[model samples]
Target chain A: MARVRERAKMRSTVRAGSGAAARGPRTLYDKIWDAHVVRDYDDGSSLIFVDRHLVHEVSSAQAFEGLRRAGRTVRRPDLTLAMPDHNLPTTARTGADGRRLPVADPQSAAQLDALARNVAATAIPYFDATAPEQGIVHVVGPEQGFTLPGSVLACGDSHTAAHGALGALGIGIGTSEVEHVLATQTLRLNRSRAMAVRVDGTPGFGVAPKDVILAIIARIGASGGIGHVIEYRGSTFDAMSVEGRLTVANMSIEAGARAGLFAPDERVFAYLKGRPMAPSGAEWDAALAQWRTLRSDPGARFDKSVAIDATAIAPSVTWGTSPQHVVPITGRVPSPDSFADPVQREAAARSLEYMALLPGQRMEDVAIENIFIGSCTNSRIEDLRAAAAVVRGRRVAAGVRQALVVPGSGLVRRQGEAEGLDRIFREAGFEWREPGCSACLGMNPDTVPAGERCASTANRNFMGRQGPGARTHLLSPAMAAAAAIRGRLTDVRTLMAEAGMGETQMGEAQMGETGA
Target chain B: MTLIRVEGRAYPLGRANVDTDMIIASEWLKTISREGLGKGAFAALRHDPANVFDDPAFAGAAILIAGENFGCGSSREHAAWAMADMGVRVVIAVSLSDIFASNAFKNGVLAVCLPADAVAHLLDAVRGGAGIAVDLEAQAVRCGGRTFAFAIDAFRRRCLMEGLDEIALTLADAEGIAAHEGRVAVDAPWLAMAGRRA
Candidate 1:
């Protein structure tokens, strides 16, 4: 450890040389980076220690293969959690007799079997396909409380930023970096700039947290937050539930941010209390004491800042291939001529052709053939409750082809069943299926058909994301449910009014109103 | 994975906001191996017979000029693997996604960010059948009697120049990693879990 001692000495010397300048206010990203740096090189690069690693099937198989080829063992198996979700089917994994079913796709089966073998060889903790805790890596990390505040987490998937909601720094790495972290629990990287995006004021009726994020992305355009880590602030985020914060943070990558963070507070601690992975009793108090100091210092300078008014946003959905192609539900489809940039105008025109829509068509009038209410983005217990509030006493429209409600995890499914949400969904003609990444991506058996339009709660609306030639419109869980009920894009606020339940009550976390 | 200068014919496919899914679709990602991804590079655009990737004129182009946000979605390194396997050594875009840029750097591929005007001019020059040259040591792109200077991280440039192995370099400092672990044990007691957290 002579090198470590020398580095420590060098660091202290630099700190003493800087004096009061080094004691100035620091942002949350700065504090976390400082705490995790193993060594700093003079060439603007640092060796960062990673605390947690979340592994999944699609992006991790090659990483495991790389480790095997290099004759290396996982450095810290205790800090890694592997789950098979991306390629696993959301169809019935268990029968009434509790016997497990075989995976129909040979490719998915082999990938999952390889994952089990790899996790076993590394002795890393794994939630296998049939495990009740097995779910999307992003969802399982937060719900299990394994993604603690003030920590660094890395995953092979881009949406790992979801853990940023809990005040952890979640980075989406590639397979090579995954193998790097496995061999050595450190990464050679450069620090990203810190940006503050504050949305103040209260949102209007039926504007869920999903809507807020969508509006933000639409305003910022694609690639707006590149090369920066965004810190979400202001009253709108402060008033949102932990689940809501998770939803918002999950889509930060869509806006081109490295990761999105919300400083930890009482809501975060309350959500983690008694969680399966959370420390309890005296340990809980100790953890809380440290986490309380995770906020950004007042007067800390940010490289960039954006201020948004929450009241100006409304329930929104994407109409084109990119998340930035969004508009309020009351708005009509935009014409290519409306775009000042020729490239964006061409992209808009091509998107309209692919989606088979005219420029003047209203959003609410666009017909949909399918509705998907699951993904790492909006498949939590809170998201399910929100959709159930809209689907409680309504039947799926006859014109709509299929409607599915896949929970994030087995625990979420069990909880939804306990709340009679399963019956509500089943009675309303929507299939209540098991959990996996499902139709959010086309990796599994559940895929949208070609030339079909679907209202999806997934994060991406990219071309051929669901399937070859599949069309996806991004929206909130409640909005997707409303679309399933009407066979078109109907505002959830309108349905809430028809049922005499105010939109404010539907926004509540407790899901109290089960309209019979 | 080292480079000093690359001079070759460049492909001019300036589509903006080209996401990773377009580079390599999810169907191609199921493979456990990283080899032969060249066939699937530009999977979506290749569906068209007139797409630049399949066009005979740019069949083996070593450089690709693209619009802003060239690689914007997914953290899949396969996007880099696909492009590298397709014989692309240099990618010049107005801007690139952070993840894609890092992945490209790791794969020995150079991601150059130039002003929009420079990129637009390069697109026209390359389409006019002029070759492009990138000099990393000089930090400049030369083509059509014009030079466009750029900046890159010094450490990254050195790594690319030396072809250093990142994982091996990190493992050389195992003592430092162990020291960090010792600190984490006391600071983050909740991190210990043998199996499932329960």
Candidate 2:
């Protein structure tokens, strides 16, 4: 009892003078990231103790293989969970030849097998492709309610920050770190200073969480928020649903911030209530009771503060290499001097060479060869609805090749298809495919042809990140769908206006209804 | 893992957004293990790969100079493992990406943070062929014979100097954990006995 009291007092003393101390509240991430600080180094970092470690096939295979060489077992198997996602084939109806897909390529097969062997050998809970609950790690973790508000979650995938939507201090780690977590369940981390980005105002029509994130990434250059943990607050966040919050947090890494978080709220509670792995009945009540306490004080301080009116955001799209190289669909390609920094200018120059775009070209004028509307970042049912609304009756542009829509999860796929979203896509010349990370990483057979330009909804467009020298223009699903029908980066608003869609309703339902 | 205070002043490399591929090209990805990564470190920077590192232009540059988000994308340990293997003691940057910074620390690569302005100043001096010294004990960096104080997270400093990783840190608490486990096993024998029910 005395020890508990002493620890509480110690925490209060330490919490003083930090940026998080500004509000009369504490953010769930602050509570979690700070609570797990095992020790502070003189270097201004902390050795954070990781509570739950999630591993995947692509990165964990090497680590477990290394452990075998060292004759070591997973040190804390109880705290670790394993799954395979990135390399899984997207076949709705599994057949014997299902394993022939590129995701099932020899390397990926070996990795999947090794992961199964290691997990079985170590007796850790695993969700393989065959597992009914299996999906993308980010999707599964939340669906299973394994990610809690006050825990630290680490995975080898960059989108691990997706878990931060639950108010967890989630960060993507490397293979060695996965090995380290498996062998110890603790991470030697350098603590990051917290930056509070308070977003106010109501979001505009057709603007989804993906657009908001893209807008933030554009404002704060890809690396502008580097080494900082962004705590998103304000009325805009307060109005968002749990799923919407997840989408915003998922792309935090795209802006170069180590992590992004929203304070836990009633929406968070309602989302986790009946989740498979969430605490049951009385346990649920207690969990909610505890989670209710997680929030930033009314006057928490911050290292930096950036505010933007959510109303200013539109259906944004990226015209260049990094996610930050973005602008609204109505905007034009930035001219040379628009990039004040020399490095950006050089990178932009090179990107222009590959993208084949003139400096002053309007974003809407640039044509696209392929259109991809899926990725863990923006492949949810809501995302599909947005795209469907635009493509419901509109035919794809004459020259468009392989226009595709891949849902992020099986549930999302089912929900979308049941609502006739698949019919909408197929009638409009879009290929309605199975749920998986299809063209997101080009790991599967779904890839952009070499030297061809594509408008993708997936995150990250580094040179050859999608394919060898494939020019990718990142955009919202609606934008991607609009481009598919127009064969160019056409503004979805103009397409909707022209299609005679949205005459009946003008708000949220219009987003759900057919645009054409 | 030896705590060798960076001796003498070395110039910052001053490259902006140096990616992992730039640090060690993908051609080097064929190798499975992280060892020998040092030999190929900075392979992309040199026009003639071998001559670049040995050239007097960057001779004895103990502290790497980099711009914001020094390491971005791809959570590859090879990136950090190679940088450590390349005899880089400290990576002085305006900022670092999360995964890269964590990898650097686990492998004993000290990532030092200075404001962007200070890094820009240091880069200017280094580009001029001025050397910089980073004293671990003094917690300061000296460039062109002028000393500038720097800060490090106290905990990471200890881990780097001691070469203690997560495994080692956990091992330090092994005895206590063992005792706790023993108690758990006695209190809830079924928990230990539980297995995959086929």
Candidate 3:
């Protein structure tokens, strides 16, 4: 009761400080929107300032070309960070003599060259392929503290939503929006309606953070987050480390959300404190005071609210093409008739046919030939450690043709190597590779073969996402490692029991200072 | 963007939750330019003999019709560019993804959302050799003696009819952006601290 009263006082204080005409109670989205809105248009859209921009290769080439076509320079080059990820090879980037090897794929080389030239021409900071900081844009942003609380961050890649885990308003944009941000440093856009997803109970043992998000997506369905920016709240997110929160938030796009966000807290402050780009000294103190206020007021209203029982979430995996077609690892593949709607039922039937599974087939009986334990979603040090725990003493199943572990960033790779995870994976017969979004989207040489099944930690399981006719079952890193061990979709609980490892052990991979 | 009205035989490929990856493959995205994406549009779907996107009757369709959550995944604008390159001027769906809608709008393609019944009705009409028309000026979709009204943001509607470059339009408000940056410098000076160069 006293806590409620304190929240009420805080709401009133927030209203008083905000220059807006005293909004009653504002959600975190509202507060961020109000702070960044530059000018409101007559059409109910506003030009909101973007504080940071991360530019990558695949979706940014046309955007830079657009800037050149219009003869416009980057409005705020300091606010922009550029790197190549989508097309770069995850294999060794340097040759035997330590000189950078030329990208084998001509198209990938051209795209990378375009990004390098664009960043060079505009004077925006860039990390080359061999740079320690070069990695997935979404992974690189928060690692360097380039993504901060209450700021708007835009990137051409959809996984830009990952930054929202740090309490920043991260928006994924198309090439056109990228061009707009490059030229104006502001997006002329309407604010997305707010949706809050609060998890109430504790996750059971063996249920990884990846399972939590997959469960949320399954519960909400594919388009549940359309036209909305979802806020991750409740005890679950509060307990989740920055890496875990990032894994969840990165996949929000798969739910069709404009972005996924969390309110800034002490954990966030500790994560950002002493980073390369984070403010230091007195400025850090000032930023901390302001960041502390970047939360939703009590009694704040959201356009939609979803509640999930965390205990109900099991180590989950997608049996079909879409992310929404997820089921617990212990469950059986469902029949299309199970869906009440004709459209969903039809889609299910098509997916089932494509996946070559019968309606009542046991998920564990479904054999997977490949395993991918990395992507923007589950490629952090913690994720790598979780997979390592499952693979520590075991060898990859003979039926499992290939299992690959690619870290999210170069630093994450080095961190995993430092912790001796590379040895565990390599000893388990898993290919421990460099970072660069390997086999996740199949843009590079590391593609899963057609007519094969893969248990991937990547967010999307869309048909042909891994490769044409490559069936992907999305699961947690531990679950993927378990699948690699079993050569089929198996429950991670039994494996966790075998390893005597609790889920809590997965959360121990610490990211101290970047340079430290 | 000059797309006030688009009248054509709507391609009846009404699959729900059509992802951008399904529309265009990742291999096709490694281009520095946006042109020549039509060949790769629905490349995966076209590999299936039963896929309706390659139906002879719907070849070079100026308007495409689909079910809800169309363009559900990925923020890649190549989906929109590919559709436009295929001569698609409008996409009518039960509902459209937010990023897809913005991308389509910026690339001179109209994304119109209507009720499921209306979309189903239009799909049936188009499959039966009837031409459908999306009139942005009237804010309505007309086909086979029936019309369905749609709601679109006025600014987006204006941008479609007038076809203004969005960057040029936003640059006109430079004063407003500068003013906001000035306020940030005073209120939160730490926010502007960028990382060191490599």
Candidate 4:
């Protein structure tokens, strides 16, 4: 009894340690980080206590298989959740691969089979591809309220930062880490130094959350934010809605941060209020009362700080192989020497070689063979509407091989179709497919033909990611749509003007479309 | 579960940016079993037929000498499972993409991280039959009789060297948990009963 009480006392006291009670106070990251610090090592790594672990078909399979091989069961299966999206085809099919073909592809079938076997073998609660609730693992976790504020969430997906919108410090894990978490519920990780990326001022019209994040990634090269957890702050972040915040956090990994987070605010509470996994009634009210206090305190310290002006950010596009290879749509390809470092300049030169473009060329003039405006990164309803607004009256360029729109979730798909977003996409010659990670990783049937260039809304443009020898340029949904119509990298701002359809402010217009 | 140091053979991939799709291609998704995954380990490599795995260059190697960002995509445990199945005991890379390294460790594959220069040296040593003995207990690698240190998160090393999965760790505390539950059941029978009702 004394031992338990002593441990409890240590837990409570530690919560107030590390400047949490100092005059300068603690950042939200610090508070959450402290709360989850199960054990601290001399070398500065932490045995982080994970509150929630989200898994998916591809990554969870082997961890469960590992458990079975060891004659063990899932230790805290109740705290674990699973969903399969990566290899699940968008269209429903007769065979098990979930493809719409007369015959199911054996490889895709095997993925589903292994997922089912693992779930059944370990009794892990799963949302299979055939389940109505199944969607991208990142989207499902937050929507189901499985992600809560002040908790440490880990997933095998890099975009696990999508859950960081709840104010949790989420981390992406590898298969062994997944296995580690399954066995120990603790990950041996080196804690990252915190960096506050403060985006001040209001965004201009026609600029969306994707633009804001793309702008941030452009400022911080693809690896600039490496080895840090970025805590996003300031008026621009305050102005974004829950979904908008998720959009920002989702791309944090693309910028090379372990995770990205926004301090919980009224918008977060409003979104979580009646969610299935959220607290209820009196519990909800109490949770809200506590959540209201979960922000970085005044004068909190950050290891590094960067201030970006929201007004300075514009709709952006990538001209090379990485998310860092970006410039404002109005800007031209940069001179390699302008990179300021020979290494980066050399990397830029190599990227240019693969892209088959010369430095100093206008970005807008680069012709594209395909335009894909979907992926977990930018496939929510607002993303769809943004693309729809651009393609409502425009037809895709004739030579474009594939112009596709894939919603992130079934809920998003239903909502988009209800609002006629699908009609606008189809009218503009875009393939409106069912919800799944299509063309996101080229696991499913949707792939860019070899050696072609595609303007995509998906994150990551590493070599051969979209398809074998296929080149990708990551952009926002609207920009992708604009490129689809013009057969080149056309700025959405130019298309919005040409179409005479005004753009919506980031959160003000979209948060109004919430399910509640 | 014993910390037995084994000087496993090493294979050199010498490739950079190996994506998950290449580790275990999308076509092998049909079976629920991981039994034969290693046979198809480098399916994408076999797609070309003349790739390194089949070439005479690094025959009988048990280690994989790879480039940076060795596993850089979706967190597919199959990739790690495939590598383990293919008799790859150690994967030495200058740097590993975070997710891939973690996955590799959990599946009983050693993902060793060395500086770029150190990795190049290790690669040259392995090719020359200077067997690298991976000591999980010491968290060090002995190549050509020279002990060079590599870092592993101590907790992960404990789990891997013991071959303990997550459940085993949790179950290790099962007695403490049951005692706590017993106390909770006595103090808050309603809560205990509530669990049963659910």
Candidate 5:
């Protein structure tokens, strides 16, 4: 019809110069955000289009039910992906045919069953527990290349900020917001301010990206990034691997930031070159050209700026419940009197009571009952290799209770096995488990028992997060491996030194390389 | 959503950094239904026999007064759902987490952020068994006949007053969204996939 032809012409005209015309110098977040804004309201809210929607089991059942109740279908089924991660048991046994056995917990089984039915009815692509690509929502997004640079992605899980490391504007949404996006492939949001967290100098020996982010959270406190989108910059982030960058961006939510991103470069392009969901042929060329331009201008302005010296950051570990209750590995537990803020002091006292620690107690002397080196935060291939390096010939201490090494994705698990990292961990008294959000939160069967203390690589350490009355101390993969070896919170640098592994030697270590 | 004008006895829950886990434990999230969450709203706190939620005087209170940074952990909307299920209409605190505040607004629960001193005064008065009142249109909270003005985003205020959810507001701009989607279909073909089977 004539009307259809007229609309086509109008769309072509709008497409000609919409995203190509450069208005002025702008931050990376601003450029991507402005390009995606469909409409701006008078109240400073905008309807922004979402390029990808990742859904998991724990928080998405209600959202899909909302859609069903409203008699609506997913507007963009092609863009939405689902997986059952939170409730998947890591220790699930397989039958003779290699199919996973039924989940033991009735509630967890029902959650997964609901997810399967929802995905089946909606026709959205899903990686079930038996699927090879099944993993944590955040991990699977990047592994499959569904998370692209210069894109806008969202999910119901809070750690969705992990995808922002690829230069995407990633955000966490509630069930209501998830329903909104499902019915219409857009979100009503108020733009967040831009913040720059610049990391200068090079990271020292045994210092990982996890340590840098934990140190940053400690410096800024939990609520410092309340309404901002942080951009991690400077040479330190530039030199980090894509996996390391993911680790840093994964914990941005702990700092209360909406998202965290890094400018796309060769590292990003290299990581996405032949990914399953990446572009190909001429589309790849065009995508690369556009992604190359997705960076902060030389003189872009930010609402707030924080500079951190990477060299000054040691192997950081959280001694209390909050992510901000962190200290260097060599430091002692903080006294309540050291806290000037009454709220912080009270929080410290409560955390101390829950953790059963005394003031001025040495951090290295704190014994741990469990060690969990897996989560969306640090369960990537690089993180596994780092832990493997520390536990190459070392044995888990006798006093320690249990140690779990869970991969982030099936692909990462396969890669680790190929590189013999799994064998190393198992030989060192760790249980190599299947990939899922195991032991991250207590949603699955893998949990720290009551009255136990764990050194975890997960982002959160809230009360009852892992299990009721279970205490958690957040640390990096290497630090967790060191703790498992010493039966206490020990510094990885000191362990490396004791093992005659120097800083220069670790610098030459590469992922998947044997005999480090 | 409904136009909320809460006037009832307020329960004093003066705890700083009260996270979502304390509000509603993860074990309670297994059910798809939002009902029955009131039974487990403050499961951990209720473990203590002396907790205020179980006290005879505050049995059916509709308002909760808490300390700073209430609802600081997790993006679980269950925290808000549980509060609403427990007949809590207003939560007065010094500060609220960004996600929790939005969740409370969408679920017909009003999260009021006042100055620390005002929250302290409200806490004291509520502990003394004073009835509290909150007016969305006036952006004010009154306790023991003393009114304290609070600040809220004008858009959120209008939404609360008009009982408008995001979907309703978004539907008002349906034509604009249609036009934008049409343009995006040509501008970025990759993002326009709706019916393409994966």
Candidate 6:
């Protein structure tokens, strides 16, 4: 505690001496990025310091081996945190007897074992499979408060943008860059152009952060954000909770953006107030004061700007392999002939064939075999509660082959169980599994069968991302629950109406349809 | 990185939005080794026996012409590794994802950006069995005597030409980094001890 207080005090003092007030108008990314530049190169590249580094099992093994081969140690092992999530089985083997199951896949077991050995040898902080904090690296970073406001965080995984919800500059790096950071604690990168995506008004009923992000991706195609960092602004983001903001930022990469962030606010401060790694007492106040200055100044210039009306966004689902190939849940599948771009038209034809959908078929009519309601994108307690509310007294539809709900982390699992959310899921015929990245990338035992269609709450919808030859439609937790209940891609609003859960109970705004 | 000008038959795999996941599926990422990835390159498309990578016409091609936003998904360096493994030295597209371009450069592969029209012309030439040549020194690509210029960062071009990796670049300024660290140790002792044991 003394050390923590001293570090906080030192940070506070440093901020006092720096020219914080006299700086010109700057975007949130600009502010955090400028603070972390250790050296700037003449060729528009800089060796920027990374405050925190998150690592996972699948991508870090080679990086650690590279470090070993070079006869060098981690430059800052204390700042690095490791965990195994991608290759773990979500199902329990003891059948309620609580006997832990050994990992059955030899390859997965070997990956985890290598990670364990690497962490132990380097003395880096790690959360093992049995550790309470074990979870996806993106989820664990924010929950542990290692992703503090105004810090720069990097990870080998692409969803590291999820950390940007706390007003930090979070970036995804490749294995080679991971090794670079491990040896030098800095990344040499060329600065990216700045973009502002301003969303206003309230979202409609059944519309979620997932819908808003998907709608954004639909409006601006996958390549719209190339070579840029996006800042999500305006009233809708202001009204959203930190969890919702995280979901939106998590998929920024899907639109080809380097990173996405929301400015810190009172809600952000409240969320981090007592997190395990958050500062305490005077240190908290000092950090809050610093965070308050992290927002964008009025009239800050952005290279590109886009405006979105949140009321126009509906419950969305992807019809094609790319996240940009999404349509409103109530809409019909688009004909490839409708696309003006030749490339998009060809891609659409391929996607339609792979998805086995007709051009004029209603999205709600598309049958689904599996429903996955967990991932780093939407596996928090709030996500679970939203899903539980939809499945409280319901049963899975007859044709729905499987319904699985895996929490984001053990802590999230315990919280949901305390609230009886797990019971609600199980009673509704949904399998309540332990926390890990289950079926998100299908790197483990939990996989969507080949040639089957699944409604998933994960971020990406690329071809075979969930499993070999598996078709995935990305949606929200509530929408996944509705699909499980209807055995098709049904809108949550219609299900809520059937359940007599009025719009007020849904706690989401309602608006008329605005055509895509 | 050896600065050998690429001159060979080019494969026209001009599909847009070809993400890294399509290049190499996540299922193939369990192995720590970067070997044998060439077999998995374009695995999804390879399922079709007539895919360009496997077509006898494009076999042993060192250049690939792809559509816009090539390699857009995931931060997997395996995408670049797979291309390198398959003996692809250059990829010409309308644009490349930032991470993918960086990975390609690090793995000794060249990612060249051209206008959609230029890419289309190249695709036509490749379909006609004409050879493609990329001249880094001239920053131009030639196809059947038609020259097209492409822009590249001078520093990156120099690194590619000189076979310099990031480690070598950083080591070039090792003395400067040490001096900066020494200054930071005094100015912010807390940050200096961030990675040090108490």
**How many residue pairs collide in each prediction?**
0, 38, 1, 18, 0, 1
* Candidate 6 lDDT tens digits, B1-198: 566589988889999999998999887788787678998899888888878988888899999999989999889888888999999989999989888988888788889999999999999989888899999889999997789999987767777888876865675666645554554444333334323121
DockQ scores of all models, one per candidate: 0.58, 0.27, 0.58, 0.21, 0.45, 0.44
Classify candidate 2 by CAPRI docking class.
acceptable
lDDT of 5 by residue, B54-172 (tens): 99988899889988778876788899899999999888987787788878888888888988888889888888878888988888898887899988776777787778767767767
Q: What is the TM-score of chain B alone in each candidate?
A: 0.94, 0.76, 0.95, 0.77, 0.89, 0.90
Sorted by TM-score (best first), the order is 1, 3, 5, 6, 2, 4
Error of 2 at A147 (Å): 1.9
Which residue window of length 10 is worst by lDDT in model 3 chain A? A507-516
lDDT of 1 by residue, B60-151 (tens): 99999998888998998999999999999889999999889889988899999999999989989988888899999999999999999999
- Local error of candidate 4 at residue A24 (angstroms): 8.3
Candidate 5 Cα outliers beyond 4 Å, as residue runs: A1-24, A504-516, B190-198
Point out where model 2 deviates above 4 Å.
A1-25, A34-49, A69-71, A89-93, A96-104, A442-445, A503-516, B1-15, B19-32, B35-64, B82-90, B114-149, B174-198
Runs with alpha carbons beyond 4 Å of true place in candidate 6: A1-24, A93-100, A503-505, A508-516, B171-198
Q: Report the candidate with higher DockQ, 3 versus 5.
A: 3
Give Cα distance to truth, residue B64, candidate 6, Å: 1.4
Docking class of 3: medium
**Residue A163 in model 4: shift from native, Å?**
0.6
Candidate 6 chain B — worst ten consecutive residues by lDDT sum? B189-198
**Candidate 4 deviant stretches above 4 angstroms:** A1-24, A37-49, A75-78, A93-103, A117-131, A179-190, A333-350, A503-516, B1-70, B82-94, B112-152, B157-167, B174-198
Give TM-scores of chain A for all candidates. 0.95, 0.90, 0.94, 0.92, 0.94, 0.93
Question: What is the Å distance of residue A231 in model 2 from its true position?
Answer: 1.8
